[model samples]
Target: MTTEKLVSEIRKKHSFLCVGLDVDLDKIPSFLLNEEDPIFSFNKAIIDATHQFAVAYKPNTAFYEAYGIQGWKSLEKTIKYLNENYPEVFTIADAKRGDIGNTSSRYAKAFFEDLGFDSVTVAPYMGKDSVEPFLNFKDKHTILLALTSNEGAFDFQTKKVEDDEVYKHVLKTSKNWKNSENLMYVIGATKAEYLAEVRNIVPKSFLLVPGVGAQGGSLTEVCKYGMAENIGLLINSSRGIIYASQEANFAEVAAKQAEKMQLEMKTILDGIH
Candidate 1:
């Protein structure tokens, strides 16, 4: 999806909510386990329930990968369902895959072409060559991991690499890559204070922010510091929304949670729109 399309969706819905489909069998309702593809079953319901309030759906690949071959099938079906049913809503394969240049090319093709995700998350630790391949895909986004929500992020991301933090250099150096325009970033809402510096570097790029709901990140603080003029923030809430209920009406309950966030986002967007 083009950046313009994503922005347009956000404006139309008065929301920039990206519901993270981080499904866990251990946590999902017991009854769903009887279904042939429980993962896809759960995802389809969530997408149906939350599409009105969400502009994007992100399925963290780990959730599917854990189920092995069946898991892979579930992921494929889930993406297909989203593309066919909710074409307007953005899809993200939160795969976090990055490797050598050639390997990265295959990864790009797998997610962008075969599976048809609008975007995929990539780790930038291997540097420019590893990431440029994904950037080569026009309109498909490469969301590079920046300041993350985990405590271990302090171990590397915030450390001084000479005069600046490592993530600052990641943001700065990445701008000169091949199709840098395709780059978006993953900034953790838990580290909202660092967003000011992040914006200073990539003022106009979209940020896929996690840690807002389940992880206790402040949505208000993230918007205050990181929001672009176009409202370039996809605030993700995984467990807080999808796992809101474990009963027969799970999807209905999930919709309510998503709408709650959407209403909050609507109020924020109202200020500038």
Candidate 2:
């Protein structure tokens, strides 16, 4: 989807919530395990229940990759279902695949053309050549991992390089890349404190923020420093919402969790207006 359309959907829904589909078979209800495609079944239920409250859905690649070919089929079916039934909802392939130029081009095509995801998460460690290929696609997005929400991020992202921080350098350098206007960033909610610094570098760029709920990141702090005129944030929640319950009423429980976040988002958007 176009960035304008994405912003429009957020306005219409009063939300910028992106529900993460980090489905693990062990975590889902035991009953679902009996289904022919338990993963897809669980995803469908959650998507149906929470679609109204969320503007996006991100399926982390590792969860499906663990199950091998069968898992991949489930992931394919999930995306196909969303494309057919709810095209308005943005889809993200949370596949942090980045490599050399040629390899990166294939990775970009696989997600953008083959899988039909609106965006793909890309690691920027390989520098601009590895990431620019993904940005070349029209109407597609390359969400570069910046200050991620993980303990290890401190190892490099926060380390000072020259006069500025490493992640700050990443943010500034990204603007010089090809087709960077289509670029979004992954700024972990755990790194919410650095948002003001990030904003000075790319004020209007959208940020795919993970680390809410389960990671104990403050939603209010994220918006306070990260929000742009377009409400440029896609706050993500995974197990906290999808696996809220492991029983037959899992979908209903997931919906309740999503509604809670959406209500908070509504209040934030109201303040913006």
Candidate 3:
């Protein structure tokens, strides 16, 4: 999907919510375990239930990788289902894959062409050579890790290299990359305070924000600082929404959780208008 189409979905749905499909079999309802492909079955239910309230869905690669080949198949099925049924909803492969130039090209193909994801989370630590390959695919986005929500982010991301923080340099330097317009960023909701500085670097770039709900990051604070004119934030909630219940009504409960966030997002969007 194009960036404009993504924004259109947000406007149509009154949401910028990205439901994280970081499904763990152990955490899912016991009943689903009996299904032939439990991971895909669980994902289908959640997608059906929550698609209306979400503009995007992100499946972290680790969850599926844990189950080996079967897990990879489930991930494939999940994306295929979304592509055929809910094409309007943006799909993200939350696979933080990055390496040397040639290797990164294959990674891009795996997610963008083979798996059919609209975007993929990429680690920019390897520099432009590693990231430019992903940007070569038109309409596909490479969401670079900027400032993350994890506590460990303090170790290197925030350190001052010269006069500015390391992440600031990332934002500034990445803007000049080939096809930089296709670049989005991952800024954790917990680091809302640094948003103004980030915006100054790339005023209209979209942000894939994790660390809401379960991580105790305030939605209000994130929007207060991070929101752009085009509503460039995809706030993710995984455990808090998808695992709201492990009973038969799990999908319905997940929808309710999504609705709660969408309603809050509606209020924020209304305020913006």
Q: What's the TM-score of every candidate structure?
A: 0.99, 0.99, 0.99
Clashes per prediction? 0, 0, 0
Off by over 4 Å in 2: none
lDDT of 3 by residue, 95-138 (tens): 99999999999999999999999999999899999999999999
For 1-273, candidate 1 gives per-residue lDDT tens digits of 899999999999999999999989988888999998889899999999899999999999998889899999999999999999999999999999999999999999999999999999999999999999999998999999988998999999999897899999899999999999999999999989889999999999999999997888988899999999988899999999999999999999999999999999999888766
lDDT for model 1: 0.94
> lDDT by residue for model 2 over 1-273, one digit each (tens)?
999999999999999999999999999999999999999999999999999999999999999999999999999999999999999999999999999999999999999999999999999899999999999999999999989999999999999999888999999999999899999999999868898889999999999999988998999999999999988999999989998998899999999999999999999999878
TM-score of model 1 (CA atoms):
0.99
Show model 3 residue runs off by greater than 4 Å. Answer: none
Indicate which candidate wins on lDDT: 2
For candidate 1, the per-residue lDDT at 186 reads 96
